[model samples]
Target: MDNSETHNQRIATMTFTSVYPLYLKKVEKKGRTKEELDQVIAWLTNFDEQKLQELIEENATFEKFFQQASLNPNAHLITGVICGYRVEDIENPLTQQVRYLDKLVDELAKGRKMEKILRGT
Candidate 1:
């Protein structure tokens, strides 16, 4: 398989709980609140606080986390670069979805307004 496919597989295996703290720290350091971070995540994944907590407690991997997600219909509206890749142009659906979240978190830490961050959804 190609290197990208291999890379994607590795990313998919990463646990959400493991990465969630980093996301939280990033936004908080930027003077954003946990509520705001959660809001951004909810906009993308449709996971309520309870469900999100459960996922974290379960140490769910990105693959499993997304499998249980009810992805927002407007997810396709997310665009731009993340980790040197254009998120909207990613061919792998899982990879694209993960990058979508990454892009959103980046925007939040960058102090983007929620309306635009949610892509006016």
Candidate 2:
């Protein structure tokens, strides 16, 4: 297989529970609360606190986590660079979804207000 398939496979196997705390801590360290972080996540994935917690407890992989997600209609509006690639330019849907969350968290940690971070949705 080529590099794109390999990239997608690597991301698909990653556990959502593993990256969650890092997202939380990154926000908290910037004086942003967990609630704020969760809010942005909910906006993107449509996973409420209970569902998010359940996924974590179940040790869901990124693939399963996204498969169950109801992506926000405006999720496409979340455009920017994450992990050196522009989120909007990512050809793989799964990678784009993951980067969408990352970009939102990065915005929150940078002190952008909720409405702005949520892209006014």
Candidate 3:
């Protein structure tokens, strides 16, 4: 009932981190294949806060996310060729997305805790 508790609770349910769950719902409706889902998971392993925001700001359709997933370094083996066009400059949303994703993947590679916090983990 205190301000600190309320702030902590709000942070716990952050929408930014919820993007993965939202993507999960769309995966089935979008008719994604297992291979594609694998690509998605691989890309998610690379997800970081900055990249998630950039993707959203670009009004990046699921297709754009999928395209970027294909190029993700960690997911590249599964994604095969990198089809998405690259943008130079961190100011560019796409570039920022890629940068964050790369950082995220690096963190995961080190076996760091993936979730900042889960509802019931």
Candidate 4:
């Protein structure tokens, strides 16, 4: 299988709760707030704070979390490289969505303004 397919399978089984704290640390170390992270996540996944917490608490896998997500209509606007992969260039739809989330968290950590990170929301 291609790298995207391999990657998809790997990440699909990774728990959201396991990855969430890393995202939080990445942003916080850059002086960004959790609220900013939440806003970007909410923009992409349409999960409110309470719902997001529930998913984390449930130890949802990336696949399960995204399957339940109401992806924002503007998610295509998120285009960038994350962990050396271009988010827009990912072949698998599910992997692309996951990368989109990664890109958003990356931008948040890099101190991007929230409005722009939300694609001008």
Candidate 5:
């Protein structure tokens, strides 16, 4: 199999619950709150607090989590480098979505205002 396919498969199989705590830790260490993280996540994925919790309890895979998401139309407005990858330039849609979340969290951790972090939503 090719490298791209392998990468996608690996990411797709990752559990959202496993990665969520790390995201929480990253933001919390920077003095950001869970509510702010959830707000940004909701803006990006349309998953409210209850729904997010449900997915977490279910241990949804990254692929399943995204598949069930109603991505915001303005998500395209989020553009930046995350983990050395440009969010808008990613060829893999799933990877781009993941990076979009990362970028939002990064902004929040950097103490950006909620309005700006939500991309003026």
Candidate 6:
């Protein structure tokens, strides 16, 4: 495929949200205080998707990931790489992760097609 086609295909096929819940589960399992959880949630709320995409492209440091989580109270107890690259909870595996990502890809493709048709692209 040509470069543009390959690039678009990558964007269309890449999956990240599948692991988001896995990350959340790991965060929740640490028994963090409510304040700490809130802080992490706040960071998530304000998180910039584009910046995160850039970080992913640049090979985001494990330190950077932890720093993002550290903004919350009780962060002192949390030190280590986040989950999702590889799931720690083997009992539940990643079957759900793949399903969630597939759903997201479908929704996104539908939205993109809808937008293009609206704009007559």
Question: What's each prediction's TM-score?
Answer: 0.96, 0.95, 0.27, 0.94, 0.94, 0.24
Candidate 2 residue lDDT tens string, 1-121: 2228888989899999999999999999999999988889899999999999999999999999999999999998998778778889888888888888889999999999899888898
Candidate 3: deviation at residue 79, Å?
A: 25
Q: Can you tell me which runs of candidate 4 are displaced by over 4 Å?
A: 1-4
What value of lDDT does candidate 2 attain over all alpha carbons?
A: 0.90
User: How high is the CA lDDT of each candidate model?
Assistant: 0.92, 0.90, 0.41, 0.89, 0.89, 0.35
Looking at model 5, residue 48 earns an lDDT score of 88
lDDT of 6: 0.35
Error of 5 at 78 (Å): 0.8
- In terms of lDDT, the best-performing candidate is 1
- Candidate 2 TM-score, C-alpha based: 0.95
Clashing pairs in 2: none
lDDT of 4 by residue, 1-121 (tens): 2465667799888899999999999999999988888888899999999999999999999999999999999999999778787788888888888889999999889888888898887
- The stretch of ten residues in a row with the least summed lDDT in candidate 5 is 1-10
Candidate 6: misplaced stretches above 4 Å? 1-46, 68-70, 73-121
Clashes of each: 0, 0, 0, 0, 0, 0
User: lDDT per residue, candidate 1, 1-121, as tens digits?
Assistant: 2337788998899999999999999999999999999999999999999999999999999999999999999999999888777888888888888889999999999999999999897
Candidate 6 lDDT, 5-78, residue by residue in tens? 54434433444444444544544565433333333333422335565555456554433433443232322222
> In candidate 1, where is summed lDDT lowest over 10 consecutive residues?
1-10
lDDT measured at residue 1 in model 3 versus the true structure, 0 to 100: 18
- lDDT by residue (tens digit), candidate 5, 1-121: 1238888788889999999999999999999999989999999999989999999999999999999999999999999887777778888888778778889989999999999888787
User: Candidate 4 — which pairs collide?
Assistant: none
- TM for candidate 5 is 0.94
* Best prediction by TM-score: 1
